[model samples]
Target: MLTDSHTHLYLKNFENDIDIVIQEAKKEGINRFILPNIDETTINKLIDLHKRYKNITYPLIGLHPCSVNKNYPKQIEKLFQKVKNTQFIGIGEIGIDLHWDKTLIEEQKSAFRTQIQWAKKLEIPIVIHCRKAFNEIYTILKEENVKDVGGIFHCFSGTIKEAEKIIDLGFLLGIGGVITFKNSNLSNIIKDIPIEKIVLETDAPYLAPHPMRGHRNEPKYLSIIAKQIASIKSIDIHKIAEITSKNIDNLFFKKNQNII
Candidate 1:
């Protein structure tokens, strides 16, 4: 019943041993993987991977903030059409990131606003990717949803106050490998945020947890994350798994379980 709330299961890193990875994770009690699409280019591969493991893998589609280039209008157009024409559980991996290039802040904001609109119209959660731009993302969300749209702040790295803001917005904080890092104070942050307001993710092929911190991440490693949260919250690992899986199912599967 464990769920990896966010993962890129179809990435190139899993090309050679994708089946092995998924099968091992399945054996480890990782029952479900919520796949977040990078862009239009990766949508087909994401879908192909989902088809192979349809019972466990779910798909979320959106334009990543990092991919918000000069021609994002054209890209968003294609993604918007896909979202409207196709059936996905949610719109995800979307938001503002001023870490890479602050010059494109406005462009990223525009894409975020547009996607938020789509999420509202479709009545689904919007998974956000915020980096060094929490204020901007929060402002946009507040301006858009007075009651707030449910979603995940993927790879969430923020203060307790910021975490509270996300919770108030009816969103969940996506806990990932960064929490397992030696110097990360995320454990302390999570100590305050209730487990109900949190979700699990690997962001695979990117952020790997301890012992495998420098290597490619897989859903099997989700066990380690659950264990970490257990230690942080002074609860059992199974409890962590049960709560996070329940929260994720309530967030995504409850919306459109069959479509994904």
Candidate 2:
């Protein structure tokens, strides 16, 4: 079985035919999905999806870096209270994103740090969302010493050096549709990284793989990504599924099996 280590199927993009999407994904052997919250506005929907697909969906709670602002402290406080009585799979899709705006860099850093501390306190892993702010995010993670809980660098497309650094810190690289894209550096990067340090994800309704690149992404398309990884790594597709699914079990389910 394949696990989509990160995806946003709770978003409105899938509202019209979510059941079809889930069914199709299962047909493709993509059985597990890790859903991360974008912000307060998405928490209810995220949790609702988990409830609806309790057997296959895993939920995470956090504030995305792009959603960070002056009022983040208040937002984080409210989110903490919402999940206080319950257990979540992890804390994240949280980190720094400087691609769109640089105005809230400090705010993003503060929010990321706070969530990391909470993840440590909660004894859960974190799912990181990093885009164009690796240095900023890396510094904070180093200071926080996130090796304690371990996590995944969601949608990782970094260099060999960066990948090595992340692996050294005890984190898995969250590989996704990007690896199948023509001209993408990710394929070359993955060749050097060990399969044990990687996990598959679709990041759907986004980053759909080749041949379906322009279309809306679905968890079912994860098989296309698996095929591409198999080609790149010179292994069978089933082997990709076996190794990556084991990686996910080790990272998310094995430790939190009782609570999750």
Candidate 3:
């Protein structure tokens, strides 16, 4: 009964054995997975995954920030059409990423703002992909005034100050395999943060946790992250699962279930 708040289950990385990978993860109690679209190229695959596992696979539609190049406006327009026609779990895996290329900084900002605005208009939550552009992302968030929409800051590796700002903005920090890294320092930063503002994610086929480090990640590794977080907070693993499960559900489903 855990959620991998952010993952790319449609990517070719998991193409060879997606079924086996998913089945194994279900055995680990990682049931639901939120799959975010990379761009137009991935929409069909994402839809197929959701169709195959409707209950367990939640699909979100959006043009990823990295995919926000010169042709992004047209891409967004197409995605908007999809949004109008159907319901999406969220609007995301969208934001600025300076890690790869900085030339498209302004383009990324524009794309992020447009998607955020769309989220506000649709009353859907967002899944942000921020990498080395916290200030830029924060500035746009502030400018857009995202008061009603909530989201998960996927693969959050920001500072305590940034964490405070994110929490203040009504967003949850998406805890992933990075938390289990030897020097991630995320363990210390998130320990004091309220558990209610945290959610579990693997960002799988990518950032796997320790012991599984340097290996191709999968949704099954979410249990490792959950166990590590529990040990970090010195709380029972069930409590971690309980709180995070609710946190993720609230982020996407908007239900205010009591976390007890």
Best by lDDT: 2
In model 2, state the lDDT of residue 60: 92
Q: How much lDDT does each candidate structure score? A: 0.87, 0.91, 0.87
lDDT of residue 49 for candidate 3: 82
Clashes of each: 0, 0, 0
lDDT of 2 by residue, 1-260 (tens): 89988899999999999999999999999999999889999999998989899888989999999899899999999998867655688998899999999999999999999999999988889999999988988898899999988999999998999999999999999988889888899988899999999999999999999989989999999999899999999989999999999998888778767644
Instruction: Write model 1 residue lDDT over 1-260, tens digit each, in one string.
Output: 58888999898889899999988998989988988888888988988888788878888889999888988888988877766545678888899988878998889999999888888888888899999999999999999982445889999889999999988988899999999999999999999888998888888988999989999899999888888999989988888888898888888768566753
**lDDT of candidate model 2 versus the reference:** 0.91
**Candidate order, TM-score descending:** 2, 1, 3
What's the distance in Å from true for residue 253, model 1? 2.2
Worst 10 residues of 1 by lDDT: 79-88
The regions of model 2 sitting more than 4 angstroms off are: none
Q: How much does each candidate deviate from the true structure in C-alpha RMSD?
A: 1.4, 1.0, 2.5
- For all predicted structures, in order, the TM-scores are 0.96, 0.98, 0.95
TM-score of 1: 0.96
